[model samples]
Target: MPLILFNKPFQVLCQFSPQEGRQSLADYLSIPGIYPAGRLDADSEGLMLLTDDGALQHKIAHPDHKEAKTYLVQVDGIPDAASLARLQAPIDLGDFVTKPCRAVRIAEPEWLWPRNPPIRTRADKPTGWIAITLEEGKNRQVRRMTAAVGLPTLRLVRSSIGPFSLATHPLMPGEFVEIPVAALKSKR
Candidate 1:
């Protein structure tokens, strides 16, 4: 089975279907039968894995597997130690409480490409980057968690999933690489 690692671009939909104006995986990938393992919102940009193997897809996407998904987030405020700790602590988002995860401040990744429509920043207020790795992905979990911790997210990017990293692959937005299913599962 073919396992594809794609660097999804900003404003691109995670699905393969065509929409009236939104761009989808079909625009970057034409290889039939491969489906996205999980979702990254259209506003978010970075690594996304696609595969034809159903079991592998389930392992990668399902929260039950507890496969870590790492993100590079730009938040509205300069997150302090207290705020960063709050990110790693269990927090409520009304519908559900988030699982404990890694959250740390990081220098802006120099290798990261610029988004098409750049993130808005305030002249008076400062913005900073934080790397957050979560095993469970709720609907807009990163955004919600950051906001709850008093650090509103401005831009969010999934830089890695399990053993697959956008850094190691180094694919530009819309670029992809094919890999063996065994290679990925073995990394687990």
Candidate 2:
């Protein structure tokens, strides 16, 4: 079994588990034997990894592996350099200090599609985007980190994991593509 890289669209659940009238991996992925290596919450969207190799799945999803995951986050407030630096710097998240990461302000991305159940818009407020990369993925880590810095996330998208990039292998909502196992293990 190889890997299937997916650009999971918004409002899509990351598992095969059925919910009452809810979308799940079963709806998008028809490839048998493959399962999501990790998960993207229904409200969040972006790169999702699917594979049948249990060892490879563990390598990608294990927090201890420190595999870098990158996200493009739209936040309710514009962040200044100091705030961006704070995100790049480590902060004690109570349980642990996050591994040092990279956070930079970026222009609104043009490559994104309109999200289903779009993020709420405030008539009087503005939003901005930031690119953040983390080696450690905790539960809703990016969302929590942005909130911790006073800039709550309005939308979050995981753009890449290690060498896999969603931009290269685009997935319309409810579609999938497959990659051979050896190909997934190759250097980009």
Candidate 3:
């Protein structure tokens, strides 16, 4: 079985299926039978895992497995200590309350690739970055969580999932690499 790590670009739909005016995984990947183990929103960018094995997909995507996913998030304003604390703790997002996760302010990653269509900026209001880790991913959960703290997300990027990371396996947008399934046992 092949496990693929793809650097999904911003505004590309997560699905392999066509979506009219938008790009999808199919636009970048043509491998037969491989499907995304988990989803990253179209507005977001970065690492995505695709595999042909059903069990491996389940383990990576299912909330019960508790695989950690980390994101480098850019928000509209600098987060105060209180806001960072709120992000680390669980918060009710109406649809569901997120689990307590790690959240900390981080310098903008030097390895990050710029989005094709850059995020809108405000000269007067400064933006900040945070590295947030979560075990369970829900629909737009990170964006919603940041919004709850009054810092709307400007750009979101998934840097890692479980034992794989973009830092270790760097790729430009729309590029992908194949790795042995055994690599999943390596340290996160």
The prediction achieving the highest lDDT against the true structure is 3
Q: For model 2, name the residue pairs that clash.
A: 2-181
lDDT of 1: 0.93
TM-score (C-alpha, index-matched) for candidate 1: 0.97
Model 1 CA deviation exceeding 4 Å by range: none
Count clashing residue pairs per candidate. 0, 1, 0
lDDT of 2 by residue, 5-121 (tens): 887878778888888888788877777898888888788888988889898899989988877899999999999999899999997777778879999999988888778778899
lDDT of 3 at 25: 95
Whole-model lDDT values for every prediction: 0.93, 0.85, 0.94
Q: State which candidate, 1 or 2, has the greater lDDT.
A: 1
lDDT of 2: 0.85
**CA shift of 4, model 2, Å:** 0.5
TM-scores, in order shown? 0.97, 0.93, 0.97
Q: Is candidate 2 or candidate 3 better by TM-score?
A: 3
Question: How would you encode candidate 3's per-residue C-alpha lDDT over 1-188 as one tens digit per residue?
Answer: 89999999999999988989999999999999999999999999999999999998999899999999999999999988999999999899998899999999999999899888988887999999999999999999999999999999999999999988999999999999999757655543
User: For each candidate, C-alpha RMSD in Å?
Assistant: 1.0, 1.5, 1.3
